[model samples]
Target: MDNRAIGRCLLFLGDVTEPGFAKTAFGLRDWARERCVGELRLPQATVSAGLPQLTCEQAAAQGASALVIGVAAPGGGIPDAWVPALAAALDAGLDIVSGMHVRLDALPALREAAARSGRRLVDVRTPPADIPIATGLPRSGRRILTVGTDCALGKKYTALALSRGLAARGADVSFRATGQTGIMIAGSGMPIDAVVSDFVAGAAEILSPAAAPGHVDVIEGQGSLFHPAFAGVSLGLLHGSQPDMFVVCHDPRRDHLLGYPASPLPSIETVIAQTIALGRVTNPAIHCVGVALNTGGMDAAVAEAEIAAYAARLPYPVADPMRGGPAFERLLDACQETS
Candidate 1:
């Protein structure tokens, strides 16, 4: 299956009452709509928080070619209840694209369903073969990385936002996606965490330079230094990207790490300090350029005040890219100053 949605219409399956892992689906939908990746069909029975949701029948009727399990469900497995609807989508001739660590094709029932319907299953998290170890060689051109306070705290969104904002200002900017959602939208990227430990930094090194020599590569970061389980991957990306400038992506409302509530969230200062310290291990000149806030689930006034507070605290531009205006322009200015 083509990594790019292109002519295909997609039905995103994410309809839980409390969105946890499914939150990434919202980002995917937004990217698809903004980039015109393909048509998104909304189902009559589905309703999500401000996002269009579609049922299997509606998606098939609307010429949707694929049903994407867009959420990163807990334990990386599809919910048992979702299997029936996914099977129906397969019967309707829609392929499956899943980013979860669990491979849908490996499930006997789902595999049989796909075979019976002649549909394909694309697992984005499956690592590629023969990935090399990092050489730590220097590369040309300036690069920017989006480091987050916690996992899934809008690092990818910040990278995408900066890419768009810089391009609008007539700057040559390119985005390097390091996660599954980004790969789905950007058409190509290495699933860094899935790659072997030895190859994680190598993958980042390879991807960071794929952009044009003069264009600024806005690299998407993975995991968080505070995330105990995935911090190694974050360190590898920091070292491999060799970023000259960095952006801190954070959600001010989150007081604890997702799925790990016992772990208290670190201060923004700590996150920035740790990120810069790690980056300097490979490139001593790495500097943080700005902060991107994910002000979801906050009142407009409250969000504005919080963002203002962050800007005052940080020595650089801070803004929520979702609400574009002066903050976004300041972010672009910061990027240009580094470029």
Candidate 2:
């Protein structure tokens, strides 16, 4: 495979390092393969070793076609380390994709540096208030299920299990996938009957059909709010569809225990409080599902306890879908009631 055709891809790992180096690298490889189509090679070139200090000379040494500089600032903090790295990557002759978690207010210097280095910059951030407002569609149903764009979040698995759970309970359920990779799975999965992708490509394949489904419509969000794939096009798709309910899938280890992105990630209590404040804007209610227990590195007990505690505080239920029976049933019940 030609390195140029493969599009040299590089990413800076921040809290992303905790997700496991191998998983993160492979995930990006899959992302490139799926999105690049026949234009580029499948396994994208990637390197990681903590968040390396980026410089023009160092970036040139990596010799990649594109670079994805990820600074895992969950609450939007930009490390001083990113500016030079962004400049270096641009000098190395690579296209740049920036995650939204980076402090947008503080990015002008980096943006200017990138421009001087002759690199294209892409930003992926979703304003909490305007995240779902991209569409004028009214709330069509009481119940809704949502999935995210990032692969690690496990949106596809959650959607499938939720659909099966709903079918088992005999609710009129319609599972809709709003991104390319997801639509592929929906086409093959027995649990889901309908699939849509291409809203990002300027087609309304997902929204138009979902607008009037008599039953509940479960839609998926593509990419992380900070990932390039989810920025402009994906947000537009979500806005047009106007999901009635939003389900946030997060890693409990990152959310509650490991203090993700920083040594002091807000506690579950804090998150709940903030969600209450934000929920009023997106929907009258919101649901959260923690997959930290299923994330393979933590003790099952820790995840179980966290889910139990978090579920109690919020208006929704949280569980370990890896258990696959009653846990999924609970999720379906929540979806039905909300729908």
lDDT values, one for every candidate: 0.78, 0.45
User: Per-residue error at 180 for model 1, in Å?
Assistant: 1.8
Q: Residue-wise lDDT of candidate 2 within 297-333, one digit each (tens)? A: 5566775666776677655566656555565566666
lDDT of 1: 0.78
Off by over 4 Å in 1: 1-7, 34-58
lDDT of 1 by residue, 1-339 (tens): 245443344545444544565555566667765422232322332434354445555666666677766666557778766777777778977888878888888788799999999988888777777767887877878899999888988898889988988888888888888888887777677788888898898889888774556789999999888887888999999999989899988898889988898988888889889888878877788888889999977888999999999998889899998888899888888888843
Deviation from native of the Cα of residue 76 in model 1, angstroms:
0.7
Superposition TM-score, candidate 1 onto the true structure:
0.89
In model 1, what lDDT does residue 313 have? 83
- Of candidate 2, the 10-residue stretch with the lowest lDDT total is 187-196
